[model samples]
Structure formats: structure tokens, C-alpha cells
Target: MKLPLFPLNAHVFPGGKLSLRIFEARYLRMIKERAGKEPCFAMGMLEDREGGAEVLPWATQVRMVDFSQLEDGLLGIVVEGVQWLHIEDITTDDDGLRWADCKPVSIWSEPNHEQDASINSALLSLFGQYPELGKLYPEAAGQSMDWSLQRWLEVLPIDAGNKVSLLNQLNSKPAFEFVNNLLHQGDP
Candidate 1:
């Protein structure tokens, strides 16, 4: 399906939440026009290649969950990842907005195992430390393996290139290993 693109320097995986500041005229117009009628957009991580800046193929289709005007007079929006998509073709509008034709990409399915208690505890502690992050997933159960991993992906300061590679995988094992190793690097 064809959708508007809102590529960023960051990433959000399926079932993740991201808060965005809408300021550019092109995007402002996009929000104004698309909100309510559709309220979904495809977001890919921006990358600087040797030629120019480009939006990577792996993207998440997010639905606007809430919006409010911030104190700085910018539109503050909270979006939730609905599905993962691989962008196929891109076209730029006259106003510099981008639109892409995309196909759904399979990501982690819910793991067969029960929720990891350690993950739940760790995430609760994390959210406690950063209440702003807590606000993003008010409805989460804080235990499912996929949910725990996706939150870690969004929370960490990993670069876009690594994120894209992790995202492009058909399953979550690589991601699980990556996050696990990173988090437990110094542990005995």
C-alpha cells in the first residue's frame, strides 16, 4: 500500500511507541490532512550514504495515538507501531514530502514461552527511572518477551545502521542475542 513517509534518525519496532515533534511545514500539512481520515504513516530510519541522505528500506507503520500542542508551540504526537513494512518505491512531492509503496515485513511473533519475570522487573525499574518512557506504553503488561525486547530496542542509544540490520531480520533471535550481549557485557 502507498503511505506517507516520516523517516527519522531513530527507530521504533512493531508494538513500540515513539513521540515525535511535528514542525516542518510538509509534515505539519501531512498531519493536518491525514489525521483521523487515516492517521497512519511509514517511518524509516534516515541514513547518510556517500551520495546523500536516504531512508532505509525497513520501516514501521505507526498510528497516531494522541496529540497535543507543546509549550514550545510545536505539535507533539505519540504514535504506536502497528506493523512493520519494507519500503519498495518512493516519490517526493513538490513540497518535499515523501510517499512510499510498501509491503508488510514479518517481525517477531509472540514467543511460545511465558513472560520473562526478569524482563518485567528490569523494565519496571527502567520505567520507574524514566517516567516519560513509562507514559508511552500505559497499557503494556510489562512481561511478554517480544514486548520487552522491542522496548529495549527503542530505549537504547544504538545507531540507525545497527537498528536497520536488526529490523530486517525475519525473526527476533538476532535481536535477542544482540540486546542480551549488550546488557550483560560486564556481567560475570
Candidate 2:
């Protein structure tokens, strides 16, 4: 399917939230056209380049949930990731809006283990300390291993290259182990 693409220098995973400040004319038009139809778009991470911006292959299908004007007088939008997408082809319009032919990719399924209470509590406490992040998500954000795993992947201050490598995995076991190790590292 052809979807409008917004490449950012950030990582967004399934069930994660992202806030963007829209100012460019092409994106402004894209948002206006997408307002009532689906409110969905594809998000790709900007790849490292010598001078120009490049987007990675893996991306997330995000749905806009809220919009407002920021203090600096720019249009701000909050979006939540719905699923993963793989770009088949991409083309940019004259106005610089990118449209991509994409296919949805299935992310890792819930692991066989039960939710880790300690990790969940830590995530909850972190969210409690920052209500702004809490407000972007649904009430059930960090309640499950799947949700917690995705959230951890989203918020961790890790390298984008590592994130892209992790996302390319066919199974989520590696990601699960990674998050599990990180959580254990904080143990007293």
C-alpha cells in the first residue's frame, strides 16, 4: 500500500507513542489530507548520511491520536504506533512529501513467560514520575511483557543502529533477552 512517510531521527516501536512538531508545507498538507481518512502514516528512522537524510527499511505504522499548537506556535501531533512496516519503494513529491509502497511486518509475539512484576513496577514508577509520557499511552501501556518490551525498546537511550539491528530480527527472543538483562542490571 502507498502511505505517506515521515522519517525522523528517532525510533518508534509498535504500541509506542511519538510526538512531532509539524511545520513544513508538504507535511502540513499531508496531515490535512489524512485528518479524516485514516489518520495513519509510516514512520522511518533517518539513516546516517554524509550530508543528506536517508531512511531505513523498517518503519512503524502510526495513527494520530491528538493534535495541538505548541508554545512556539507550531502544530504538534501525538501518534501511537500500530504495527511495523517494511518499505518496498519510496518516492518524493515535488513539495518534498515522501510516499512509500509498504507492507506490514509482524513484530514478535508475546513471550511464553509471565509478565515480570519488577520491570513492570519500575516502568510504572518511571511513568508516574513523568505524567506527560503516561498521558500519551493507553491505560494498559506497561501491563504485559509485550507492551513492556516495546516500551523499553522505545525509551532506551541506545544507538539507533543497534535498534535497527534488533528490529530486523525475525523473532523477539533477542529483544526479550536484551530487555530482561537491562532490567536485571538495575537490581539491588
Give a tens-digit lDDT track for model 2, residues 1-188: 78899988877788789889999999999899887555378888776777976787778988888899999999999888987888899999999999988998777633446556766677777788888886776575436766776787788877666776766676556777787788788668
TM-score of candidate 2 relative to the true fold: 0.87
lDDT of 1 by residue, 1-188 (tens): 99899998777777888889999999998888789755378887787778977788878888888999999999999888888888899999999999999999777543435345666567777888898988887776645776787788777888777776775666666777787787678998
Worst 10 residues of 2 by lDDT: 108-117
Clashing pairs in 2: none
Q: RMSD for all candidates, in order, please.
A: 2.1, 2.3
Best by TM-score: 1
TM-score of 1: 0.89
Alpha-carbon TM-score of each model against the true structure:
0.89, 0.87
Poorly placed runs, candidate 1 (over 4 Å): 50-52, 109-115
Cα displacement (angstroms), candidate 2, residue 57, comes to 0.4
